[model samples]
Target: MKVHERLDQELSKQGKTQAALAEAVGVSSATVSQWRSGTKTPSATNLVKVAGFLGVQPSWLSYGELGGKTKTVDPKQRDAYRRECVWYHRPAPQDAGRELGNAAGFAFHGGLSTFGRETSQNILDEAQPGQPTVEARYTLIEISGSRLNSFLEAIKFDDLKPHLEAAADSRQKVAAVIRRGLSALADDGRLILLRVEDYGAKGLVGPEYDDGNYMAVVRNILDSFKGDNAGGSYGLGKSVMWACSQFGMVLINSTLSVAQDGKREGRYIGRLELPWHRLTAAEAGSPEAYAGPAWFGEKDEARGDVTRSYWGNEALALDTYLARDEDQPGTSFLIVGAYDPDERFQTIEDMHDELVRALAANFWPAMVERAGDDPGMMTALVRSERNGVTIKSDLVDPHSYTPAKARMLRMHRDDLTVDSLEQPGDVVRRRITLEVPKRLSDGAHGSQQHEAVLLVTEADEDDTDANRVAFLRGSHMVIREELVPGLRMGSRTFHAVVLAGLAAGGEPADKAADRFLRAAEPPEHDDWMVTPDVSSSYARGYGTALKNFRIEVRKAIREIVGRPTRDLSDGPDALKELLRINPPTVDTTKRPRVKSAVGKPDAEGRWSLDVRVSLPAREAPWRFSPVLRFGTDSGAAIPVVWEKLVPETRCTVTGDVVVAEAGAREVRFHGTSRADTHPVMASLATALVDVRVYKEASK
Candidate 1:
């Protein structure tokens, strides 16, 4: 925070005009205007007078120091200050309906890895125009005892405790999760906070509650104010942070690229999502019902008690555990009471690994540097701490995780791709034509052809998730990865990349393709398809064009790597005449075959298993139900029910069927069998698992 920022915020907060402040401080109104504009600083004597008039300490007004301390606010004034300093929105009594939970938060499957992907995309999308690279950091910190107590006091947790407790008693599904979060805090006396910070990017800049990045992220829902070329447009990505939090609360601190209120740093606020609930007059100051969402900031009484972001001081920021290390333009999101709903990341170390893996898998292109001078679009780092002790610190190296794909990206960036591959490490480039249809509103007659670049190379033996074509557009974020279809049996394993739009780096058609593919993306932005936006915007039969475009992409891949069919007629004539050569029989076993399985009994006597299954390539999604059993050497296997099933890669669990994404050759999942369902103790039995393809009963 700066002196001008402090002066401006205090003037608005106190409802005092600049002229009034100047009169009180014995200065001309023009002098005060200069002070507010940051053109001149107040003299020491004038500073004290100005502070006294505003009822704030001179040190705070001058340099954002609180009571002459650097990191601690006055303990006695903590609650009182928060009560008066921060605004908390309660539901209006005359509202027509109640919202149980945030629908946007539920849009994503709550997991740490998913959170990483969404946040990283947001960071990359906000990269500064001329900066070489944007830097993102993920920090997991555990606090307890005094440290935790101070944080709770700073945020005025008491103001929120009654609402959380009331919502928990309501017994809604989201409330049940909140109940467990409260229980864990009481039982362990600790809280885990996940802070995502980015540098070299645009921060939350604009009016506190109007049309700008600030309002788009902090004050509104389903309002993505990003450009057409940005990675995400659904405006739901930020909800992932709230979903990851066990407490449904997230705090924000941003340093704006453009100044707001004559200042550019320490813009801080917090938001809490809870179900609508009522409180008795005894529990709160008055009997009240809330409308499910609340904000933490300076209360604007003039605006129906709505809260707006506050210009935070160093002491306030440090106490809330949101102090940024640098003065760079970016934002930091602190997920209060953060926890992985999937339970895959039980320890900080697990979280560290997941963040790195997720980033490398989804944004390797943005992390790949070109040859000489130019840097990649972004860099990432992950750090973990327990009670202020560093447990792990990793600067993610994208090449280490996705070597083949990263190499291709580097080659593409440097324009080093060859026409065909002749040796190992060679990248082959070709053009796949995409027929982009004219928009329905454009009044155009025909479609335009856009050339999308396709890069392919032989995959390294150790490369994981190889032989898949990654789709990217203007943002260079992977939209989806799928195996190329129509490849001959025994085709060499390879890695492929389809770069369209600006990522293709040439031709005016790039912009047209970018707009087309962007409109085709759903809210998750995971894949491009025939979406409502696409249907309403494009001409008739646009879906067919999209289908053909995908087909052409696959056809190009096959041309690059598919082996030629063998000629049976070349064999001995007598043998060939007698032999019945089947024309490439298709594998009808849609069921995934278990390639490997491992398990162990946990302390609760439940069998925990990690299984990998391989499937035949197909355009349609494969659906299967995993069956768990206890096996014996010479006896019938006993069936067991799974207590939990978590998809690990390229699959999703819906109802009872695990739907593997189309073109997935293999998938991995983790399961824990119900101990109660076991015929005997899990430790005394061998776990057997099978995946059965789901079949619809014939009428």
Candidate 2:
């Protein structure tokens, strides 16, 4: 039937005028007329209203009559809305190359919900770092905008506040706590905390800048380590922190360089200030070359607010700013006006650690001598709920000791050098070696250096041409076409250069090194049979220094904060109070001090403490074997190594291959050879096993 006829019939039956129907249906009469003429179709929702106005159910207006229910929504519409809701709740990418739609993915925000706030990253990334400003120092504009402000607010760090306070609070607190507990344990007089975690994605970084060049500046600084340009490279991990902050990052940078390096040598401490100012798009260049270094040609390094205490421009000479005076100099940062991190990164340690990790990747000690693994430096990363003022290494931190000697070491490179003890020019094939020593390693760990090398790799074994490996006390050993058998420090031997290479006395692992021992094959054109670079050697030295340093520092920190509890929530105030001490009463008669010692000091004459070590007595016999299996059936006739001697070793020991029968189970030992009785003799026990296994023949 024609829609007009049907509509006319309906209207006639209902006794309703066009205007009345239009009003009832909440639309113009023309719309109703068009629906009737079939020029346009009434929406399903509208049809239902029309049917109600016409005294009929919606189904009767179209297909058929309905008992009681209202017409259903469009299937396509229902599907679309359901899909839209799903999209709204979907998750974003977590890392790179992520895909959506499986379990979790894209989500839409409610127009008025807090989730509706734009989450676009505030890319502080400018093509050129400090493009708006000149030099490493930055002075940024006060960022403003709703979303921008939200991001800016997101950067606020309540956790960072305690850390900043601790960095500034009297070293007395630092010292007292360290002294009362472990500070005295440090050979030098300081402690450091390092935390490393990756920046999930590239993040904003650069110093403060009032100039419009924020974008360029950020890019330059963040990518500074790339060193692709003619300009000086900077570590933006620090700079960006300075930029977005109202108050500048604190500068506590200290150097352990002996006094000779001149201006950069020694310990120093001071505030790294960034006073705020306005900026424009044209200023990212050398200040002297472009704007003229002199401030208005009147004041030198004098910014308008130069005299303000909050400014970051105080320049203290190295010698005068450290140690005894208390405020040691080192790099510390506090950012202002930044996007707050997501809940996933709610703590200051998280934020700071993320920045550090970015630095770990960006600055990777590859450029520095003696780089260690992917982490680069063996830093002691710590997270503290204690008011930060009491932060000190636990006794087990990686960094616990001496700045030199017997330190935890990371091997970067090594070359097999055989200078025949008695002959000249008598050469041997060079072998490269990389070693991460379990003994010299200082850091407490998830996977500790307490064991020998965690891994090892040979050229042929690793197809990529890289020395890929992880080592443990008795892990599988990889041999190569170039290998020759020998003996080494308690382990199978190879060459000293190889050991040195891995031990910090050989070639240092630089940014480009690919092998564990920095055992790179020298370019064909080079003629030296084996040569280790000074850089590599220095790297070994550095690792040694770091290991020792960590040990020393950790020793001190542990002494400072002792006594672990079921509750790890001790506040910083507890540490401060622990460090406080009232002076002891004195008679003043004979110079109040310790009386003469009842016992003479040891030959070393220094305070010494007992050190303990636990050794495994019996390592379960582990054997790699050749197997023979019966096809289909579960039985096979084979030599039982447990009862028989190995063909080769048996000939060497007993001159025969005979042994006790398999079921007898009475033999003392068995192996590829009869001499295998001593197989469990761990080489490391050569010096110390006697101490643990036997009581000193009493009298």
Candidate 3:
């Protein structure tokens, strides 16, 4: 390629216009255009300037020499380059008002667990094709003295300190958090940086401001370019990284699966999110009003003097503490001034444990190994360091952390599930249908029935989250978990998994179901319900479909693990008669009566009861208070206050009254007695419940 050809190619590849190059090189557009057209050759001085502007070697640009390789700028010249490579604060427009804080950062409450879950989901979403396992490692490092200063200098903390101080001076809600972070660094002279690295995944690729993962994550807000099966659709997951940083800053280093600018690794950039503020003319050389965010990179004069990512070398990566252990295709995020927003994790140990626990709890299925020789989708590790010394390194083992669920997933993958659980470790599989309504855009007549899988097995005695059904879809990350309702008393404690969409072995309707479920998820991606996306995209009855899907899942669980009916013949007749009260009698003239009641002692020693009431049909809603008392064998019944009452069906609970739906015959409500109000242990007492007509002075 000729000199003009190489120049033209670099210009096009870098998304730089001839006018931009001309302006940056202090030359006329006509001159640069002529040089591109091979009508003129640049002088040595302008050629070097042009090469520097385009990040190429002068010899490579002057001739087809050096294979047109990128210039590796020396670290000694960093200060000289720093003059051009500085933070670019976005100027606030005249018409718009100022922002107090970044709304996206507030999407999460800044818990370390939230950080782990969100970051891991992003890694799994970017899993490389044919890669057996995507690995995510979390490293927390505390540095002070010269080490801290060197790190801060690499990130140009001096340029950022002024902005942070200005934002904190405003005394806004976000400023309070900024103040605390500043105080910690100034008082303790130590700062903790959390570096999150992922391996075996597609890194942030594409142009700095175009439609790709890099732009979507770094430059935009609420713009997710993920596919239907991706765990995050809202694009708010990345904001949690900034939220975890007390200074609202995160630096990124990515090794791309696909090359950009003739390089595949050492892509470095930093983004700081702050509120609108103004810098004094004395400090900034000119009074400037900023709209909020700022970028740390070489100034791209081609794109309105905005900052774009720099292609650095190994030395630069090491200096920033973002050097990856291997040449893996993934991205690393370094959260500056890292601290748990909720303050639940104070020590490095607490943060490490929280990350491991969070990753296991939310992503155990993804970490579970398949049957036989196949590896799981992902693995994770959490470690802490102080001044280059490793304090703790924990490899999150899904089986060890969540044994029951992991076993259930393995059985599912191996097709080793049975029809019923007859003993310990027995896995039962059932098919539940999710009625996915046709999209409004489809113009179809009926809905697609997506078959979802439900796995249930007897939980280990030590499992704290037993007797709950965990719901997951394509990502294999738990979207939500709920205690199985309507299970019979003394039902075997078990763990259940509901696999929908692609997680259910990629059925014919998996794609459609995945799309529908993705639409149902909120920005948090924590639950599936009738969200705005679902309401606008799908036809009517989408909400009912989701509700039915949940109901069917619980019903299938009950059928597989519900306790069998007790045999009355096993007990003495007199004892049985005394123990069992007569069923509620039907009478048109009488008030409502309690038809059935079943009570069990919860882990907290509270008596939890499921009660059914029969009310005579009436035009007006029935108003009655449900009272709870402990039945004694030889004394008056002991009264206990109702701690919580939730209406299960055909009723609305207000205070102590159960208002049956108008014209409703039966009402089902669940209530728990206050443990503190109990005279004896809940296990030692029999629960008695009754319904009374509401009166003004009733108690």
Candidate 4:
């Protein structure tokens, strides 16, 4: 393919004037004319940059080759790299036009845009006044419900086989409709977490990230596919998946996503970056800041007369930090690929259970809003016709659990922070109720011990008045300082309370068997079992199991602040918690009750607490609206809310979860309790012995 001929075709396809294309690539019209006339070739380096801007591959532009190379590397590093790329980068190239990074835009059907700078440039002239600046990013975050099912569906070779048989080509050609849907997922993430409209002006809050982590995240999510798994039937989503990534090649888009809910989160598009010699954080005047004028905390800060979306610029009057790294840049898709049951799940049934938990994690409120009052609005990735969808969590928590008792979980504390990253973020605490069946053992579908898994880390994070009032009329919490895992993985001090039902040995014994038991010593009898079979009797038992389980789950969730799982196979705690702390019911008029109980340590390596303390709540309402608020507290109108609480629904977190911890040293936990308590009796029918060290006493 002649480079000049290809260039003209792309210019015509992009509906852009050559002059306009020259301006975007920072090349003179004369240079473009030369390349077009075949008088001269673009330098390899310039070609690469130009290709990126046009959403084409340098390999295609330079060597006229196809099938961008699939990365192969050390598995662990590959997995980590994939997480960063899939969650941070834009979608991968899926078509020939995309592979070429055609600037004229691929022949993608079904959508048209009047807003994007690229689109406008294609329709208008260069640097025209009144033209809006192109966005630095347009990202998407996607999560799947049943990995087995999604993966299975993604690999419908039989269906694809027919298409392949008809054509000599075996390379996949995704239907345009499918591509649009996949694009929608990534688009939703960007729209929710990065894109914003402030006072009639569209804006962005996320970084125009150009890092390894981001690129890998985008690639893993938008590239890889799965073959066979428990519930997966056909691999249709794969077509759109590849198309989504390639779209960015031409549009400067980057996406970040994870295959499994809690499996990974990071940049997907940026992983396409080639490594540089060495880069680090350097002092400003001693040198390394952006060269030009800027603002400290002003909304829509301009960058050298260009106002896209940048927080820091102008380089002076502030402290600076630099980050430098060493390594020849490469990419991987380990975690992103490994998550899809790559021949090691042990059993299909076990894979199903993992899918349930994955779906139930419901952690992305910015992407999809879960409303219990309005079940229709409670969108989750884990949806089924009969039950509903599960959601992935995003809090980046390191908590774990086990079945022990039946109890009510409630709100513990909701703290707010302002000026966190030069700005502030609010902190909230949730206390939830979890149910534990008396018998403790595992099973195919439902295990008695899994009932009490609070899964609070995947619960909600709410927005309220205290945070807004403290910051400015429209403030929301931004996760400025992420709670990183301690050297001892789960060692952070997570303040929580397990409100067990009377059945789990609470003050008031509340039992579920007495109210819904099918027989005596239920765990031993097949009739009383929740997973003993597919018989009518099993279905009957499942009904009773769901009924009792939902009550405790709902109560526990009311305290969680963000979106939750509406239909969880185990406890449904995630969904219930999301419903509880949605802020609509927030009576912020009251002060958050942060109670401290006085305690004294004893010689037996233990401590006892008995002190008078008041956890107070004083209701005082202020502006709770996001953005566009006149400020109930002040007459001056400002940007109402900080973006985090209601962040543009994109996957912002970009990392992997370490292994779940064991023993007292571990901090947050999720699991069923050892004993079940009779709510009516307020005592466990059985005795307990396992103890977790919530904390140690000070000397």
Candidate 5:
């Protein structure tokens, strides 16, 4: 065999150097050089090693036939050698198209966006010149009855009782004992509640809906890092749910129907993941050594003891009581002792209200308007029973939620419309090409240059206005309403959405878009990553696109503001316009009365006075000035320290004072948005806290 020439050919094919191959084969460079130069032939053992390192059959390297057909060997040894030849030097499978580096492993099917840039480009090109005014209908989504279930006391123990008794072995007795022990526990004895916050407005639980890619997001992490077309590349988003639980864990319940053996079977899977600990360091083969992580459910004995479903497991009865008789397939998450890392909300109610309102702000368009090919008109219901009253907190249409927007909507709809929708005063949509930096050539998905679209709108007048645009890779919004360089449209607040098309020459645009989206976002999907200098081609591409978008926005703003406007201020019309611009404030004199008191014991034996504070949502981001005044039973003013309340949400706070006497403790939160000053100054709203102290604490 001309081994030297063959070695040279394989090296060239793999683009490997002699030194690299030598290191890989655990041989000296000189020996590899000599073998390649035909100066010497390796021994039989080394020859087999050489063939394996080159990912070729030893017989083929020794003789001249593929699959070692020309060589003779023992049948058993031949099969073993073939197996070795196939994988000994083979590298782990990888996607060359992805540039996510450490995040490359999360490119799974049904991940994020398949047609990111392509669809974005189509939308940009196909978007009509005018910004059409769309009408939206507002309604309430009431989620009554029990939306959750307790797993501790509710198990199919009767289904397993007969099996436990009929087991003609010790395994049966052990199973029966476990079942009896678990059955004796109360509902809260070992049970927890899981909250699954689905992305869109409509939670994943509806009759005509399918769980689709969301199921992958709930079930697995780092499983998506495979192909180029994955929707999400960073495996981090899946961990957000797990980390939300105080135990860094959660139990998942999903309904799935499968067809096996020509029979359609309905399956409800309850699964949980918990980290196992070892009491002490023991030898690897020890019977009770520490195991890292284990599934909490029934184990499949035939499959090397892999846990199946938690539902039929005797130790834990983890089936859902929330599943309906007319069952619509969806998912629920049970986070035992759920706690927020941000410390934004003190209780479950506060978190629910904050989340509902935040969702309304971020996805208002998707909820009110039809998002093409996506879930239509989303709704979320956060319901809980408190003090004999079932409180359901739901997101209403923006017109109903924000008072400022509600006022604007009340005006004649025709007056809000401009004669020409795409005219300067109406809206502007521009599709432009961006020049890429010259340094970004090798990593370029297409040519160094790419295309992007910019849209600017001057509709919707809310005083607490943020004029920012969203950066989109495809349909997936990379960055929410953010300001880019040169994007400041002064005085008049506006809304905008921008999209960038990215590409490198080797793959199709859609595939390139997948790589772009994967590399751009971190695992948590909070926002696009800000690590271009330290990241892969994907982040760098976004950086470049962002820079280009800023340039385009500056130009569009200049063109749009250059138009003339009609003067609507003449005598009586001027006064009316002034009143509309500077709205009146709510009268603080007629504040809500809080006469009830509720007290609970604190951990330190000190009585905790729970107060329900009512603060209405604001139309804009403004600081609230809260003034707390305390009065004694004899109508004497008592001094008290006012804690800074987070203006973002309404919450239940614990009052510090143990009032010996109480008449009225007033909290008036005032703001300047509704005032008639230049920057406006008026009392936006007030707050009332229901406090209960050890003594008389009612006001």
Candidate 6:
């Protein structure tokens, strides 16, 4: 039957007047009359409304086909027939050899209702660490209205409103329902649909691997390591992009670097919507069915083979929606149905903030040119706003410490040097080395360790603080602030910012240290887990090298922070030397005032003296130890007694001297090591007595 006859028949069956049908469809009565008289056809929008008004499917009004339900025949069979009718009845394509029907075939057996805002977001969270790098401005535009109608010819399925939401288990449903509803959202001015534009030197060109079948390698290629020191273990970052879209659907449009014909023709368009149905081999392979993955770019019908598949951007659909005139070499991701408002990406500002923060945390070093796995530089630019509110890594982010900290470290690179641990290994395969630079600065020196830039500054592995060390590999700071068990120092917590590189100390890769450092790194590049398991020679070597590094760090710390010293000597000028050693640091302005000693040599040979010393109360914490410096003599032993007397054979007497509340103390000297020699007592007093005690150690 003619389309007008079908419309007339449906109106009569529903007992609806032409005027009532026109009113229901938001059309003029004259237009309805023209449609009924076969003078004109209704637009795709009005056709759907008129069909609904007459209690029929739009396919019935447009193509004289039955609705999805049937009594005598099976409902599944009838639904299948209706889908076929819709495809065949689609208006003839002005462009030859383009199969728009393939878009519908990719729908799975069960509807794609399993994917939603929350479900998709979960996938994104797990896959964030592996996102790809493209230096470009990524723009997401919210579009609707007649702009959606323009896709009717390329996308084939016209009335997508009903199928937008179907039963989760309903299989063999139309493919375009979700897309239609998202496009229809123009009526409400909501940003349900989004077109993502990734612009710059690198675009989203179609993959040239896996025999030009991107599906075979899209998910698998991510597993390969882009760099030895890169942070991610598995390359699943792109999965997050699909997860953010409703029904795991997105259109990829980009110009490839591959050349075809005489020119560098590389423009290509493709769709990455995993199939929903369990299709037959023929259906899965047919471009018309588009049952799994499909290419929708320029095709040369003359070729009449797989090579004829449009691998360039000559297709009108690709050109109109993707802005082919930009002439840039980046790709655009068209997320037909973007996720609804969520906690993380509720508004454009929210999205901008979240993405920028993530980038700074994981990729700041690369973004700011501090480090990168590739020789060619790559940076991230997210433009969620239409008015150009861009987030850059070079700017200081108050909430995040990575970007600003890394930038500061780059400025002080001269102060940093690669510390290494030497070990036994082949000259070319050595790996026991740490690349993080250790710097000693007055501002960063104190009783408490100061935080270092580009290093984990926390002691707790699970906690975020500026007191620990980060393990660096490739160009990434893989493990942040991992506490080394061997670095502990009694009750005093030891903190440091440590890192290792591919090589240290100018050692070749064959050296044991170099091999150990590289061998200890896990595939994930998160931590150094060198073990003593002999079965793995590399692991054992790594473990040994790591132990050496820990010991070196301990030694270095001790040298930086001096230890207490105790020495005694007896010479003619020993007293003078003792006085000099007593004061750790001599500041003329704050020297301790020493009064005179009141005693002379006694006949009994016991040296005794009453010494008076005055010190500021704040210096009370400084304890004084006295040493006796005797003249060079072979005569007899001299011992000094404060708490215990020393024998005469020892020329010098060193002991802790107790001071009374009156700032006076008594000292008796009878020269000898109490354990070895005879005692010779001498009583002496001299104004040159050194009364200065302990001085605080300074850096």
TM-score of 5: 0.44
What TM-score fits each model? 0.69, 0.24, 0.70, 0.20, 0.44, 0.42
lDDT to native, each model: 0.76, 0.24, 0.78, 0.24, 0.35, 0.36
lDDT of 6: 0.36
lDDT of 2 by residue, 67-173 (tens): 12223335553333222211001112233232211110112211111110111001111113322111011111122234232322222223223223322233432
Off by over 4 Å in 6: 1-136, 145-189, 192-235, 257-266, 278-295, 298-330, 340-343, 369-377, 386-404, 412-465, 477-499, 502-699
lDDT of 4 by residue, 618-682 (tens): 23211111111111222332222111121111111111111212221111211111112212111
lDDT winner between 1 and 6, please give it: 1
Worst 10 residues of 6 by lDDT: 421-430
Predicted structure 3: lDDT: 0.78
The window of 10 residues in a row where model 1 has the poorest summed lDDT is 564-573
Off by over 4 Å in 4: 1-240, 243-447, 455-540, 556-699
TM-score of 4: 0.20
- Residue 604 miss distance in model 4 (angstroms): 22
| Residue 365, model 6, lDDT | 41
**lDDT of model 3 at position 59:** 48
lDDT of 3 at 292: 80
Candidate 3: 10-residue stretch with minimal lDDT: 565-574
Scored by Cα lDDT, where does model 5 land? 0.35
How well is each residue in 181-211 modelled by candidate 1, as lDDT tens digits? 8998899999999999998999998897579
